[model samples]
Each structure stands twice: as structure tokens, then as C-alpha cells.
Target: MHPLVRWFHQLGSPPYFDRFAARWAPWCHGIGAVTMAVALWLALFRIPADYQQGDAFRILYVHVPMAWMSMAVYLGMAIYAAIALVWRIKLAEILAMACAPIGALYTAVTLATGSIWGKPMWGTWWDWDPRLTTELLLLFLYLGVIGLYAAIEDRRQAARAAGFLAVVGVVLLPIIKFSVTWWNSLHQGSTISLTGPSHMDASMQLPLWLMVIGTHVWFVGALLARARADNLRREAGKAWIAETA
Candidate 1:
């Protein structure tokens, strides 16, 4: 096996993660910052607004990516929860715990931007649309995990509870994914489709993809840094952790 594989396995042990984070966090920060800058330039200025929607369509850059990330992050949390539950890995639990708040923030951004765009396009800000409603519920699920984690004092106990919450939350995700298709809604159908045909042009499509890549990278940076901090706090008294510090 590769030395990096060995390093990753040791990461579940905490001390190695701290050392890894100490060396790599700065790089992650730097890259994410640069990526954000490039994404802003591409999304805000280089990419022209829609022909029909005009300035209103600009919201899609933020809205679409956040909506996608919110769901993607939740799915990730569920996977981490499963890993923690099955393997009894502290690192996985902490990673799942760290993912919830960020995921919630992304969900909020999705809803808020969707609302902002809706006012101009649909002539209304709020809707009982299945897609919109299901996404809102996703935000609530994120908050539930965060709150449940904080409610308990013991880290192990808290993680187990949060992990369980995340696992249960997984069932709601398919509902979010299919909500637009399954029910009537003021919201338009998906811009990008799995089978074929993205309802967007190259001018619009390029920046949106850039934003997606940038955010996924942001997710990695955030998850790793937060997971590293978590390991530090949990492994506070260990000889290796101390030596690593």
C-alpha cells in the first residue's frame, strides 16, 4: 500500500491528522481562496446574464451550486455516519458532525437565492412547491443534527446521536431529488438533466460548472480542516498529539 494510505489510516488515530492538517491546511486555504476569486470573475462578470431572464438569471450561479452542494453534503454526512457506525471510527463521526452546519448554510443559500430569483421571474417569492418544500426540510435536518450533537456533553455519545440522525435523514434526500418531477411547482424543471439536455447555454453553462468544482473543493477543504480540529480536541492528552503539536 502507498504511504499516503498508511497516513490516512493513521488519521483515524488523531495525532497523524493534526500533523497532516498543520502542514496542509494553509495550502487548502490558499487554493480555495484563489479558486473562489476565479469563480467570482467567471460567474459575475465573464458570464453574461440570460437573454430572457436578464439579471435575474445571475442568481443561478449561486443558487444552483448551493442547492446541489446542500444535497451532496447531506449524502456525504450519511455515508460518514454509516462508516462511523459500522467501523466505530471516531474520525468518520467527527467528519459527519462537521459537515452538518456547512450543509445547512448551503441549503439556506439555495432557498434565499431561489427566492430572490423567483420574485422577478415568477412574480412571487414563496411557494408550496414540492422541490422547494423538500429542500427547506433538508435545512431543518441539518440543524437537527447540529443541535442534537450539541445537546449532549460527551463527544462519543453526541457523535453517535448525530450519526443516527444523519442516517435517518438519508431517506429524505430522494424526495428532494424527485420533488420537482413528482409534483407541480412554480419552479422550473432541472437545468441539467441526467438522461440528456441541460436547459442552459455555453455562456451560462461554463461558469456554473466552475462554481460547482470550486464549491466541491471548498467542501473538501472545510471538511478536512474541521475534522482535523476535531481530532485535536478529542486527542488533547495523547502523547502523539502533544508531540505533533
Candidate 2:
């Protein structure tokens, strides 16, 4: 194996991951928090009102970012699951477990805020659009992961099984992304993209970006903190606990 891959597998040990998570998690979360705060405050009061949606349009900022995160996090979960399955790494399993709730939260936020935005734009809160349907499915998928783990007494077996589901669920993500373009829907096409933002102006774009960063910060902080807590609980009788604690 390559040096980087070997390093990653070794780093999957609980103690090493816990220590590294301790350091990097705080830094990512802190920087992400600062970034989000600056972006949100500026967006809330400074940006000019939308000529169409007015102040209610502000919710779009939050909605879009969370929607993006909903998809991104599912992909992240898949990667973590793959790591656990291929490497048989214990920390990788826990980390995969850690990501589910965070991903679910983003999915929930996406649906709620999308509803708030929809009331004015579409005359209804929901219309069974592909994006909404797929996102709902995504949330169910997260719950399924959590449930699968919870139902099992054996941690490793549970992780492996749930990890398989996570990997398979990612196949649905692209269908959600292209659903707007592929089918007729009230939901708008991608505003933010690889080649600069498409529809959302910088004013709308700015706050949405901030919310994304904030969500990311929240994801990192919550996951690592949970991961650390899990490590402590699971390693209650291990030698490292006595040494570290």
C-alpha cells in the first residue's frame, strides 16, 4: 500500500483518531464558526432586499445551504462507510456512526426551510418534488443506519452492515441533484455551481454560503465531540482510559 493509505489505516485506531480529532476538530469548527458568523451578520442586515420575495427571501439563504449539506453529508457518510468496510477499522465504524445524526439534521433543516420558502413561492409548503422526496428518503436512510446499529449487540457486525447501506444510499444522491433539471418541478435549478453561482445573486449567495459553513462547523464539532464521548464510553476498561484520563 501507498504511504498515505497506510498512514490512514493506522490512524483509524481509536486512540490516534481520538487524539487527532481532539486537535483538528476544534480548529475546523472554530474557523468555520467565525466564517459563518461574519457571513450571516453581513447577509442579515447589509444585503439589499430582494425585489421579488422581500424579507421572506432571507430564508432562502438558510434553505439552500442546508439543502446542499444534505447531499454532501450523505457522500461523506459513504466514504466513511467504505473506510470501515475495506479496512476493518474500528474507529472508522464509530466515525460512520457519528455522521448519521448530523446528516439527518441537515436533511431536516433543508425540508423545513424549503417549506418556509415554498409558502410564498409556490402557494403550498410542499409539492412532492423530486428534491424533497429524495431528501426525505435520505433522512430515512440516516435513521436506518442508526437503527441498524442500535438493533445489534455486536458493534463490529452492526457497523459493517450499516456501512453497506450507507454506501448504497449514496447512489441516490445524484438523482436528487439532477431531479430539478430532469423533471418539471417548483424547485429551482442549482444556483451555486462549479463555474460560479448561476442564479442566486451575490447578496443571496453570500448568506447561503455562510449558512453552509456554519452547518459544516456544527457537523465537525458535534461529530468529533460525540466520537470522543463514544471513545471514552466504549474504552471504559481499556488501558488507554486510565493513561489518558
Candidate 3:
């Protein structure tokens, strides 16, 4: 078997994943925390303020990462959901379920920080801009998945149901991604791009990139923590838990 295939097979084993998550969670969290602090320091103290937005632009350090994570997490969830539905992989199901609350939290953070930033610029707490509206819908979709899974009694059945919803809701992800470009909106265009030069100064962009990487690292720790807890609960009667404990 290919090395990558073997690794994935190992990952699907509950005991292996549980042990891996236990060992790696702290490292992920520690690195993420330290990186976030450095990013915050650079954003708040080192980087020059925007000429137009001034100090108000500092909020991007938080808001931009949260926004990016919100969509990235959902896309991840959808992929896991697809895997679970196709192959009935138990690990995939747990991962898909675990992603919902984390994604929702990012979505909430994005909304809150966006609102705070907007108040000074747009002179309002909220606006029904295309980007904002689609983002709001993304949050609702996350909540819907969480609620639907909880409302069902059987774990497997609930996972399937929620997985279906997650798969269907993927349509919204593209909408959220393109809303700014597809329509006129109060939101600005992308500051970073893969195919084009960034529109930001190198100093400003460095901290934002650090924050984005830190957010994703932190999310891995959170996801592992949640997946472990859920695995224990779902396997409360299993022998592996006793052996590991």
C-alpha cells in the first residue's frame, strides 16, 4: 500500500486518532497561542496604520482571519461529510460533526468584529451587503447542521442527516466567496490573492498571514479536542477507552 494510504488508514482508527490528538493538541495550541501574540503585537504596534482607515484598520488582523476560517472550516466539514456519506467512515463523521461548532464560532467572530469595524467606517452596526448577507447565511447553515445532529437520537443516523445538510449547504460557500466580486458592496476587494500581487504592504501582510496561520493551527487543536471528547462519548462502552485510560 502507498505510504499516504496507510497513513489515512491509521488515521481512521479511533485509538490511533485519539492518541495522536492527545499528543499533538498541546503543541498545536502552544504554537498557535505564541504566533497569535506576535501577530497581534505587529498589528497593534509595529505595522503602519492605513492612511484612510488609520487605527480602525487594525481590526483586520482579527476579522480577516475569522472570515477566512469561517469559510475554510465549512469547506472542510463538507469534504468530511462527503467522505462519511460515501464510505461510512466513522472518523469522517466525527470530524464532520466536530467542525460545525468551530465553524460557527468563526462565523460569529467575523460578524462581531466586522460590525465593530463597520460602525466607524460605514456609520452603522450592520448592513445587508451581499458579502455580509451570505456570511450570515453561512452561520445559519452551521447552526442548522449542529441543531439537526443534536435533535436526532441515533449517532450514526444523526451524522448521516447532518452530513447531508452539510453537503447540500456547500452551495453557499461559493456565494460567500464571490459575493464581493459578483456584486457592488460596502466590503472591499480581496487584499491577498494567489494569482495576483497583494494590494497590501509587506509589513501589514506579514502579521495578517501569521494570524491566518495561527487561527488555522488553533482550530486544529480545538477540532482534535472536540473529536476526542466526542469519540469517548460515542465509544463509552468500548474496550479501547478503558485500555487507553
Local distance difference test scores for all models? 0.85, 0.83, 0.94
**Candidate 2 per-residue C-alpha lDDT over 7-46 given as tens digits, one digit per residue, 9 for 90 to 100:** 8876767788778778888887888778777877877798
| Least accurate 10 contiguous residues by lDDT in model 3 | 198-207
Candidate 3 lDDT, tens digit per residue, 1-245? 99999998998888899998999988889889899999999999999989999999999999999999999999999999999999999999999999999999999999999999999999999999999999999999999999999999999999999999999999999899999989999998888887999888876798999999999999999899898888888889789989978
Cα miss at 126, model 3 (Å)? 0.4
Question: Which residue pairs show backbone clashes in model 3?
Answer: none
Give per-residue CA lDDT, model 1, range 106-210, as digits (tens): 999999998898899888898888888999999999999999999999999899998999999999999988887788877888897658988887556777777
Give the top-scoring candidate (TM-score): 3
Q: What is the lDDT of residue 204 in candidate 1?
A: 63
The TM-scores of all predictions, comma-separated, are 0.93, 0.90, 0.97
Would you give me the overall lDDT of model 1?
0.85
Ranking by TM-score: 3, 1, 2
